[model samples]
Target: MSPEPLQTGRRRRFQEWPNYRWAVLGLTMAGIASTSFPITVLSASLPVIADDLQTSESAVSWVQTAPLIAMAVGTPIAGKFGDLYGHRRLYLWGYALATGFTVLTGLSWNVGALVAMRTLGSFIGAATLPASMAIIMTVFARRERALALGYWSAVTALSPAIGVAFGGFMVDAFGWRTIFFIQAVPSLIALLAAIPLLPDTARKPEVRFDVAGAVSLGLAVTGLLMAINRGPEWGWGHPLVVAGLAVSPVALVVFAAVERQTADPLFPLEFLARRGFVIPNLVTFLGHMAYMGTLVVAPFMLERSFGITEVSRISAALIARPVGFSVGAWYAGRVESRLGGRAIMIVGALTMSVALAATGASILAGWLAGVIALLFVAGVGQGAIRTPAVAGVANSVDDADLGVATGSLQMIGHIGAATGITIMITVLGPSESSERFFAIFLLAAAIASASAFSARWSPGLGTARSAGAGRRSRW
Candidate 1:
């Protein structure tokens, strides 16, 4: 079927049901929450899993590492696939695959099996994000996109928080395996709901998949992520680290060359060169780097500097960040039409920078309430920036390129997060000193400040609004 007809059918359905967009958003959120549940749960259950499987902590950690690598490698390719085939089709398949793998993970007898299953699940689950974003952007008008994306961001922030809060209890009560089993229930529900709720995009049968480009790009991303993830564990000079560092650049070069030569490129280099597209992604990259980097060090800083030893209290403090995030996201969405994405992003980034700086001062002053307050403020900034950044990227691209554009944005954001965490680890360096914690926050502040500059170039000023109108006319 032609895309026009498929889209017409979807539009008619929506016209028939005024509230169908809400149903789409709800289903998408369910898929996202279910897929992300295991991330935090597995982290909390790592020690128990290691004891049960008779493995070391470092070895068990691969359960997390493998999935991170897989998701990073697969995300862009999955997005392109959605563009070629159909977002709805890819999303449904992703949920099915994730559900199956979740069950298999529950049944795993050893760490190796668990890692393999979880990695496969995450690889497939990565497809849902770009597909969901594309759907939401398509269904909502440009003016309302930021508001919709705000809800998406809130769910993204909340899922892990919910998982972290209840994960340890579940692990202790039942077992690590039971968590996977429980996760499968929600995934299955999402899969079934998606069947009727989600609409398919028009497939491009004539567009060829860039198999060689996918392979090379996957290898490049995997190598880089592996180097960052394992570099600290294995000395930076280790043969594996050296090889990964060397291979990634070579593979990236090969991928770039392949993209230039291919008739139908996986990532259109021309689209990447657009100021609107590139700048929003760069802002997202830097913003996430600062957010995740600070997050990595905050718990330890709380324990050492403020003498908060209880896990519950520390969790409560951490919860403040996400709450602030939810509030900021919703507020940004409500006000984006008046403020503009660029202005909103600049304000958000500066807010985060100020919060991070305040956090450092609070730690030095040994003020616990001040630390929590600062983190909450930082979360608000993080939440506010995400919606506009995402909407800006979505609006900058054509409808067909929406999947790949959003997917690449997410891929870069994840890479930034990995880089941020790695830098924080390197700075902290086997020490629990106040000075190192202060240094980490200061570095995060610098990164956040840089994001404000990046936001200045964001296409959000006028380009996105006009582009969105053009896209709507076509639909």
Candidate 2:
């Protein structure tokens, strides 16, 4: 379907600014934390979970793979659902489903049960990632959207950093299942918040659910995730891997066509094709690719090269990440009110490059402090780029398709981070040595800087100076 126009003017009925902003933003963070918590939680819990299930580490590793596979497939579909339905309602349901599965996950008796339950659970839970953004865009004005996106981005990104530092202790103290239990906090909190806090505003639904598009895209993403996830273990050239790799590309092409032709496609082709919407997604995808390198490999390097068992606590250095992200977001958010998304994105991209290179230098030197400081810088850049990036898309497009746009944004994240991590691991040699990782950071840094250049030519998404400000919004 065509892009829906955003609701203009002041908030109607009970959906006031400042009030709805905090609550919705809080819930967005909570939803993202709960949905994606297990990815890192399971990593921490692997020792206990493997022992309890009498499984090999290699066999149980699918816990991470399965969820990504599900989420990769589910994200866009869920995004479309949010657009078709109400994002607020869908957010609540996503939380509710996540809460139920999390509880069931803690009760599983064996690895098989655990894997199966989690597979189903991820499909339901991870939908919140995209849905939350859709709801936020639906509620906020164009000028306010960037800062809102900025704050939301900071909180969501901070979750894994928090998970890394704390997940280990939580597992050691409360057992691995506590990870699942802890996830319930967000679900319960968001569910409660939605009752009184979620704005009851609704869009005049326009996009029709494309069943064929759903199946094709779902199959393609699931197949691609499986191929990439298993490629590390199974060998990318394995017959099944070859088949998955071959199928996904074809399906992806078909999925693109479906969007282009369908009268009311599940995903709008214009947003994906447009510069404002597409450029930031591309740069952010690269940024996430760089982040994937840090997120997955940093601790491994520390553990192997430095022999640090208390790496979890050391990982707390990443707290600096949220610090940078928040600062970057606030600054860029303020600028997005007046300047434009393109300019802010360029700064964020530049920050990303510097941070990634510094990260490499620190890795080579084996200094944890340097690494942490670099991460903080990278995060700030990430924060600056994302707020305007998303606001660019949200402001450019009509509101009816806001859910689709937001979901597409997040889906790019999942697809890029998922594939990028796999690719980085493949290239980094798995040795955890500074030399082995040096290339990783260098390459990531290069990508960041290059993406910055690309952002300049990207299409404009348009921007609001600020809802409260008395100026024109830029794109």
Best by lDDT: 1
Q: Single out the weakest 10-residue window by summed lDDT for candidate 2.
A: 466-475
Superposing every Cα of model 1 onto the true structure, what RMSD results? 3.6
Best candidate (score: TM-score) = 1
lDDT by residue (1-475, candidate 1, tens digit) is 2212244465567546778787788889878988775565576567789999999999999998898888888888898999999898888787788789889999998989988998998899889889888888777776778888888888877787787678767877898888888888988887876776677676898999999999999989988989998998888998988888999999999999999999999998876667767777888889989998888777788888778887657766787787788778878877887778889999999999999988988888878889899899999998888888888878777878888888998889888988998888788877878877888899999999999988887656323345553223220
Task: Give the root-mean-square deviation of each candidate in angstroms.
Answer: 3.6, 5.0
Clashes of each: 0, 11
List TM-score per model, in order.
0.94, 0.88
What lDDT score belongs to each candidate, Candidate 1 first?
0.83, 0.73
**lDDT tens digits, residues 1-475, model 2?**
2112223332243365558666677767776765555555567677678998899887778777787778767877887787777776676777777788888998888888888888888888767766777778766667677777777776666666667667777888888888888877777776765655665436446646798889888878877878877888789889988999999989989998887888878776655446666677887788777766566776676677667777455455546766687778777767677777778888888988988888888878878778878888888897888787778767656676667776777777777787778878888764656787888888888878877987887544446533311112223
